[model samples]
Structure formats: structure tokens, C-alpha cells
Target: MTTTTISEVKSINTPSVIQINADIPLDQALEELIRNSKEISITRGKRKGKFETGADKEGLELLPESSKERLQADGIDIQAGYPEAPPREDIPIYLDQAFEIRNYDVPFVDRGKNADPEKKSLFGAATEIINLTKNVGTEIVGLQLEDLTDQQKDELALLIAERVVVFFRDQKLSPSAQHKLGDYYGNVEVHAQVAHVPGLPGTTVIWNDYQVKKGMNLNFATSNLSNWDSTKYLNVGNQGWHTDLVHERQPAGYTHLHLDAIPDVGGDTIWSSGYGAYDKLSDEFKKFLDGKEAVYVSAHQYLDREDPFGGPKRIERVHPLVRTHPATGWKFLYVNRGMTKRIVGLSPVESDLVLNYLFDVYEKNADIQVRFKWTNSKQGYGTSAIWDNRISQHRNVWDHEGDQPRHGTRVTSLAEKPYFDPESKSQREALGKYLHQWD
Candidate 1:
């Protein structure tokens, strides 16, 4: 108490400090010494590359006193900072740069909405029939295929998308003209294997009668009815719940059929909405088919040989039991009569039971069905029907055999694959509302 040692006072330059070696200029080294309070055990010749610390004599320089002091003050912090963090190598210079942000949530709005009024009104007038059926199906009147304007063509496209199917009564269009009208929808491809009018290049005929031998260009009959189990000839028959030839890797997207010389009393064509078919199923059935897939094969009804139609014996594919429509984004049952074979992860017996039940449901629901009776109308000449194969099914009645010879030509389009949308609940609701009307 009587005497206090000067050593007790903190030294501005303490002897307890460890020596530091720095490969720097004398002036710069001196600055570091003052800044870190590090003692220089060895100094340079006051020039570059001449300095070396005592620790460097053997290996690396010892810790400076200032560093030790910092460590003692914050032991954890020092340890954390020095823990094996290597210098960043090959880092991208723009890693932290800002970018132009974009909003993807907003849907693209139709620019035609704000187009010039005069131009819009002109197109509107011609597309009136198409506009009227935007929410439901309608019969087109006072419009001929040959007389359609560009506006009318645009209107027809919109109508087909909304109504799913459109009927032209008593059309005076020849096979070629009808084919041209279908071209407006998209490119038309002749059916792979069907009767074609003689010398009519690009025309595929749909005549079912074997009696007519005049101007015989192409005469082909499906074996579906002839050989019940044979699916080859029936390859194109009763393609239930399917668009068209989905068994192919690329299926036809659109099909147009003209009812020329229809029987007087019978042979009406029936169409069922596959989208509606899915809506009518019980929740349990829907859930069961949600993730399941099936295999579809084509066979013949009449031919006994393996190569019934000189095509591949079986066309097998794996498609979801519930497929979504591409444009409308709505889900639908994908099973059909022509090709669907077996369900994945189910026994043969179980698959058959499930498929049969689904078939029964589609067959029984009259509300989801529309039967068009062809009657003589002043509208035009041939009774033509155009439908999107992506979401609808059609069948012909054999009852009109003896009345009037029924035959026509069809043009198919290879359009985009069908897809489903989760947001198409509104479309389903609208379809449900019209269920009773179909019945």
C-alpha cells in the first residue's frame, strides 16, 4: 500500500507483447505497430522484402500482443471469426446485383377489348351467331360456308370453343367446300384408313353401306360390329370417352362430319360430354381415379388375323384415368370404347368391374347426352357437325339403314394435346346447369 510499482500501470508499449512480422515498408510497418500495439521482434532494412519476424525464422509469426488482448477480451468472438473460413475463390462479381422483377400472376388480357369501335363493330356483326352461343350451344342460321367473311370465320372459332359442338343444317357445301370450312379451324388431315371419293385427292369418305358400288374410290368397313371382340376394324368405332385415336402418340384434335343422305327415321348421332361425365361421378370414384393410369389396346371385331387392318396389332398407351382439357383446363374421364384396356395397380377382375361401371355411368346419363335427329331443313344441303374431340364423344345409330343411304366425308385436325386446369370449376358449374337441358 505504501509503494505502488509502475508495472501495475498499463503500458502504451508493453514488454509482455509478442513480436509481429509484416512484409511491408518500414513506414507502413511502423504504422501497424502503433495501431495494433504489436512489438517488432525483428525489423527490415527499412526496404521491401527485407523484414522477417522471429517466428518466421522457423515457421509463421507469433500472435501479436494486441491480438492476444482482443482474444482475451472476446474469447468466443475471436474463436467464431477465425473458425476455418477460407477466402472466397472464384466468386461471381454480380452475385448480389439487383435484377428486374416481373409479376407472373397477372393473366394476359385480350387486346381486342380496346380495339377501334368501328372495326370491332364490323367484326361483331358478322360474328353475332358465334357470340350468342358463348355460354351455351346454339343453332347457326342464315350463314353459308362459301359466303362467310373473315369476321364470320373468327366468330366460328369462338363459337366452337364455347359450344364444344356446332350443327349446320341443310348446308349446300360439297365435300371439298366442307373440307375448306374445316380448314378455317386448323389444318385438315384425311383419316388414316377410310373410304375416299374416287379421284377425289384429300377426301376421305364415311359411307357405312356396302351396297353402293358406284364411283367406288375407297370402301372400308370397321370390324367393330362384325367381330365383337375384334378391335381392328372397330379401331375407329365406338371410341368411347376419347377425343380421337389418342392411342396414337399424336391424336387428332378436331373432327368434322357431314350427314349427307341421312335415313328418314333413325340413325341419330349421340354425343356425350366427357367433362360432364367426370362431374357426375361420386366423390369416391373421383378420388379413386385421381392418380390411376390405364393401358389402351386396339383389336378387331371381325378379322381373325393378328394384322386385321394391316396396322400395328395393338396400340398401347398410359394415360391418366382423369385427364384435363388443355384449353378449358377442366378434368375429364379418359376411358373410351376403342382402346382402353387395363388399369394400373389393379387386378384384371377389379379393372373390368371399374371400367364397366364407368361405361355404364357414361351410357346412362342422358342429361350429359345430346342426340341430334337429322331432318330436312331449309338451312342448306348436307347436315354437317364439327366438334372438338378433346372433350366430347360421339356415336351413330345403325337404325337408319333401310330409309336413306347415309354417308359423308370427314376432315380431321392435329391440334394441341388436351390438358386440364384446376381453375375451370366455373365451366363445370355451367355445364352442370345445362345438364337438364341435354336430357
Candidate 2:
């Protein structure tokens, strides 16, 4: 029988090599057991007594009763913990493409055709549209997300692209159901870096008190906490407003956040419209920024092992400054105050001036924004907000003081990379409406 060493596995870049260094002691114990093993005749066949169990006694005790029974039936020592390593010949190693990180290709089908705003037409079933703002957010008052027809889901996608952010109250959407809904939109982003629901791949647990309750830290790559120092309080102005997953090769499209637990008051979320922000700029300014690109950096820093100083480096991506929504064929500003660092092909000072102005247009403007309260008056509990990440920036307000819990589950679907279409018109331009621009 051929025996493969740990070095051999490491040479091939086997993903399980991460465990080898830590499991050296177990390997040593297995070697000792094998050296001292005594052959015994069992019901199945002749085998080494207790030598087959590679685990320690404590490890075996920690295993489930069902697992122990199965091990006992297999003639393995249940009391002694670790299971014997199968022969190297039995373990086949094949290259898996799933281990490689690649750009997500979203199946983009424009569903705006199904969104007929006629007398009998709405997004399937009975519904009342509550416009939170003149431009950005809307609330679809009737249907449950769990029970949506394919046609209805298409229309809903269209509505979210148009409205930017949509809110639903008193809805029962489980983690599994949420994942399915996200998949319908696009490829649900399952981030290995974030804290997610147990057994649920794409559902990120957004519990504010998770660290305190679970004695574990929940660090999302989109969070800006790692970028700041002791001067954080003074430096954190308007930096919280950001589009989700901007550093990704294929950025976020639709982000659905379902808040199950919310305080009696406060912890409201505010979403700003990219469409409105773009319209706020002058025609000349829009023309200038139409094909420009910007650099976006991820919030978390990774150690640069190759560097002599061993300093941390953030993941960076370059995307168009102005991006067109595929569903609407409308151009919108894509830079965020949080992750967006600089504009390409411009000097440092020029880039800073331009980016700061663009940030202000989105964050400072109140008319193009929607602030939604999670605690419904009737439901008094669950509320959901599904926003189009392509044309919006959102911030979670932590105004709720004391130990009041604010918890939620979020599922984000990755869409196509940011692209600017010169043929795409602004919302106002497409609608033939006049927009007052900044002087």
C-alpha cells in the first residue's frame, strides 16, 4: 500500500493541509498505537484491538451516542475517541473547482416587462404600494415573500431596481426560505469570513450582541471598524454609508435583511438612492463621470506574509464610478463613502476632491433617502428590507441605547461587475422630468 506524507499533500496544495500541523500529536499517538497493537479475532474479521481507534478517550466520550454505537458495531474502540485513518489507497484525491474563488456570473433577465402598473396589474396577489420617499424606498403591503410565483419574483426584482429599497412588515421568512429567495435573484454570496446561521450557507447572522452573548466576535469584511484607530470617533463622519460587497469581483446586487428581533425604539436603517444622487449632479458633471472608474477597498485587512514589516493589506477592486442598472437601463452613481478610495486617471488631490463631493451628494441629501423603522406597530417584531445594492447605499443606525437586542439575518446575492453604458439615461432623463442640479 502506498503511503502519502504530509509534505506530499502540502506540495499539491491540498486544502486539508491546514489541519496537519495541529494534528501532529494525534499522528504520533496513532503511530504508537500501531507499534503496540495486538491482533484479535472479531465477529467481522481479525483486527488490532483498540489500535483502530486513532482518537483519545476524552474525544470518544464527547462523541454522540449514535456515533459511539456505529463505531462499536464497526468493531472500532468507541471508548478510545479518534477513528482509524483509512488506507492511503482508499482515499482518492481529485482536483475540485469549488475550492477556487471565481467571479459569480449572475443570470440577468430583465423582469421590468412583467411590472405593468395598469389597473389590474401589480406584483401578483393583492397589494398596496407605500412610497416611503418620492424616489427611493417603497413598501409592498400585501404578499408574503415565501409564497411568490416566478412571475411575481421577476416583477419584485423590477420594483426593487426602480425603488432602490423595499420594506415588508409582519412576514414569516425562515433562513432556508431566505436562501431560496436569494438564489432566485442571483448567486447567493456565502462568505466564509462572516458569521452565518448554523447549517445555512448564505444567511449571515447580524446580531449586534452576538459577541457578548456567544463569547465570539462577528467580523464582516464590509464593516469599517478595522480601518479606524483611537481617532475613530472624530474620523467616522459619513463613512458608514456604503453599498454592500463593493470589493468583490462581481459586486452585490440584491441584499435582503430580515430583522427578527428589534428594540422597542431606535435601530432604524437608512437607505440613500444612487439614482437620485446621480440626478443631483450637473449635466456636465454627469458627462465627465460617465465612463470614469474608482477604486474600492475591503474593510478587513489581511496579513501580508511576504512583506518585511508584516503589515496588513486590504483587498481592493476597481469599478466604474457610474454604473447602469440592467433592469432599468438607467445610469446611477456607484461610489460609496465607506469603501471607495480614489478615482482612476486622476491626481490624488483631484480624486479626493471629486470623491468627497460625490460622497456628500449621496449621504447629505435627505430628500433622496428613506429611513425605515424595523419595529412594526402591529407585528411589534419582524420586519424585512430588500434593497438593490447596485443603486443604493445603506447604514444601520445604532441609536437604540442600553442592552436592547437588535438582531437580523441577511442574504446577499452577487451580481454582474459594475459597468457603465453611455447609451443609458438617468431616471429623470428617461422620464423626461426636470431635475434641479447643484450650483
**TM-scores for all predictions:** 0.57, 0.71
Q: After superposition, how far is residue 2 of candidate 1 from its true place, in Å?
A: 99
Candidate 2 lDDT tens digits, 1-439: 1222222123555552322233344434333332333331110111111222123344333333433332344344334333222222221111111123444455655444355534133443756878888888989888788887776777788889888998888776666787889988888887634445544557765655432232222223323442232114211212267788888888889889987667788778899999999999998899899999999876444433234135435567799999999888899999876688899999999998898888889888999999998865554336789999989998876566324766667899888777889999999999898977657
lDDT of 2: 0.66
lDDT of 1 by residue, 1-439 (tens): 1221111124578646334444444333333443243232112111111222111221112222322232233222232221111112211111011011110122222122233423443344443443222333445655566676666555554444445677767666665566676665554554322334333323455544421221112223432242233233332233223446565433455577776556668767777667767777765667678768888653211121322235323445566677765445557777765557889999999998898777656666786677777765652356777776656666766565434566566777545443344444534664565322221
Model 2: residues >4 Å from true position, as ranges?
1-100, 104-107, 110-124, 212-239, 377-381, 437-439
Candidate 1 runs further than 4 Å off: 1-137, 199-202, 211-243, 298-312, 378-380, 421-426, 430-439
Top-TM-score structure, candidate number:
2
lDDT (Cα atoms) of all candidates against the true structure: 0.49, 0.66
How many residue pairs clash in each candidate at the backbone level?
A: 20, 1
